[model samples]
Target: MAHTAGGTALTPAMKIAIAVIGVLVVAGIVVIAMLNTAGRDGAEAPPSSAPTTAVAPPTTPGPLPGATPTTGSEVPPPTAAPGTGLPPLAAAEPLVAAPLPKSGSRDGGLVAGFPTSVAEPMEDSDVVSTSIATENTAMQVSLVSSTTTALDEIRAHYRALWTSLGLREQPGDDSTMAFTGEFESLTLNVRTTGTGNMYTIFGVLRTE
Candidate 1:
């Protein structure tokens, strides 16, 4: 039998051919849709024109929390404690006295620059040794003599001499006594030399 959609008759081979052409058209339409979907997935979208927020850096540095601020412009100077400070020097102006003399005494006689204020051992005393030491700022005189004068007279003579010069007598036994004055100190030592009375005098005079 022959079938026709319009006026022409359709053969078996012609019908099969028409079915194949219809299948081919459907396949082409499916391929086109799949290609469009793949293109959309692969391509990047255009950037947005909307504004965005951003963080900014600080303008000035500051100390951390819990930090303490220092006080005042400077520290006060240290003060010397009472009695613990250096001993008073010669009891005079400027307070600090010069160093002691270092010269030695060898032969006998009176040393040069012996202070007239410090009286000699005695007119009859036999001199054992004498020395004179001088410095730019000070002078030291020392005398050693052996005398037959009475112990009381010898002591009294020096005691009166030291008192006249306004020196304060320091504590001492019968053997030694030191008289302290302004700018100087005088130490007189007396002892029995077995044969006679021996006396030694040390005078330190500070000049200017």
Candidate 2:
């Protein structure tokens, strides 16, 4: 053994002990490092392949229970009413004043066997309006005022006049009268106006 200044040299036993302690420490460190690496790998590993719960989308509202479905086409038009095919009623015009057989003395009066009469020539009595004649038919609407003649008397007068002319009376009520003959037909409608002293008469005449 050699002695240095103020120091002693180490023995082989002491060196062996130190070497074993270092080996033990290194082994412990390696074991701790392996445990830490295992913990980290477990935390960072990919998840399992099992199916996940799926979140459903929100729902939309539907139509009411009894609602009817609409179509793209347009609705159909309404049907026409019954008995609307007759000619329209129009206002009367001036008369043509053609000569007629058996006509009344009044200037605008009906011809013999006709349905209506012109207003009598008196104060405030005149022909109001007449219709233009077609090929074989015409109409006249007039207003007649009389202080002496009642509505019943005028109606009766017309009835008697039509019967005397050999025109057969068609079935009608008090407000309407119809007469037919061999070559002509007539229709008369009368209504009282203004205190029952004036009467409006509408007549249609047709000739063969």
Candidate 3:
């Protein structure tokens, strides 16, 4: 030991040893910090072959078996009543109207019982070529081609016409209309065919 001014002094060898220990401690702390940083980076990184969730496609419903699908705004034809002897409702035939006789006889045209004021004859090339009428009662089958009128309009026209004439509308199907008054009754059958541009009107009238 060497005595200095009022204190003991360390030797060169001791000082050198203390300095080396301090350097070793700092180096150890730096290596631990670097290892900790590398571990955190590895934990945060995403793997290249990670599993992913798959999305499914949407499904659509289909019609059932033996079912026919309807198109557009047209309603399906109604079921036939029992024992009517009439075939299942089918598309109407496209009939062209012929020139009428000069005698004003709608013989091959609409039935006679239809009100002349509310009913008008169609064009020469748009009406059925023949008509069926019975005596003592105006029962007729006539087909009139309609290129501009809609089915609802035609239905409404007849409804308003009969109601104004003091007739009550009878319940019927989509292809048929019925009206009954105190002394008269009428039935109208309507259908569209041939590109849906032509309409056929069948009429039956009875008087008391």
Candidate 4:
């Protein structure tokens, strides 16, 4: 038998057992080194893609710079009324101021609806022309005559007739007299023409 340095004698079985333990130790060391190397390299390497999620920015929309915010004080303009086609302030104006239509007379004839009894040619006066018409809801009657009667006489004649007809006298000069009442208006004028004094009677009545 061969004696070892520590005084134990070497045997085949003991050597084989020792050799198996050395192989196992080397295999364990190699596994530990590989695990350490993998951990270090993974820690040092860059990521293949961006971080899955980073700090996100604000997501709400805000007003633009210098834009004004609503304050609930806005208003719209008012609409105007539709037109009526009459003159301005036409309703408020006097009836005499209203526009009238034109009229021309025919010789010595009475128009339909003329009040011949009240406003015909004076006694002994020759009727030269007469006219009657309607305009703007009013009635107009006119008479022209040649009279030898003086202005004073004619005035007295019509004044009595007007008084009987319930017509009140309006302002007048020596040449013209005006009377108005009961929605009726009249003017009598005596003018000196080529032949003689011409007496003209013009009247307007409210047709209403």
- Which candidate number would show the highest lDDT if scored against the true structure? 4
lDDT of 1: 0.75
Q: TM-score for all predictions?
A: 0.48, 0.34, 0.37, 0.47
lDDT value, residue 2 of candidate 2: 75
lDDT of 1 by residue, 113-172 (tens): 455556565889888888868777777788888999977788889999878767789998
Worst 10-residue lDDT window, candidate 1: 91-100
Sort the predicted structures by lDDT, highest score first. Answer: 4, 1, 3, 2
Q: What are the lDDT figures for the candidates, one per model?
A: 0.75, 0.55, 0.59, 0.78
| Model 2: lDDT of residue 143 | 36
Q: Tens digits of per-residue lDDT for model 3 on 42-111?
A: 9999878968889765575455577777674356789887797878855332121223112122444554
The residue pairs found clashing in candidate 2 are 109-118
- 1-208 in candidate 2: lDDT tens per residue? 7788979878998899999999999999999999999999999999889898998855854555777756733367898778878798554332223343332424354334343433222344444333333342343333343334565766676667667656678998877777765544555555666644444444434432
Query: Alpha carbon lDDT of residue 148, candidate 1?
Result: 92
Which model is ahead, 1 or 3, in terms of TM-score? 1
Per-model tally of clashing residue pairs = 0, 1, 3, 0
CA displacement after TM-score superposition, residue 166 of candidate 4 (Å): 0.6
Which RMSD values do the candidates have, in order?
A: 11.6, 13.5, 22.9, 13.8
- Give me the overall lDDT of model 4: 0.78
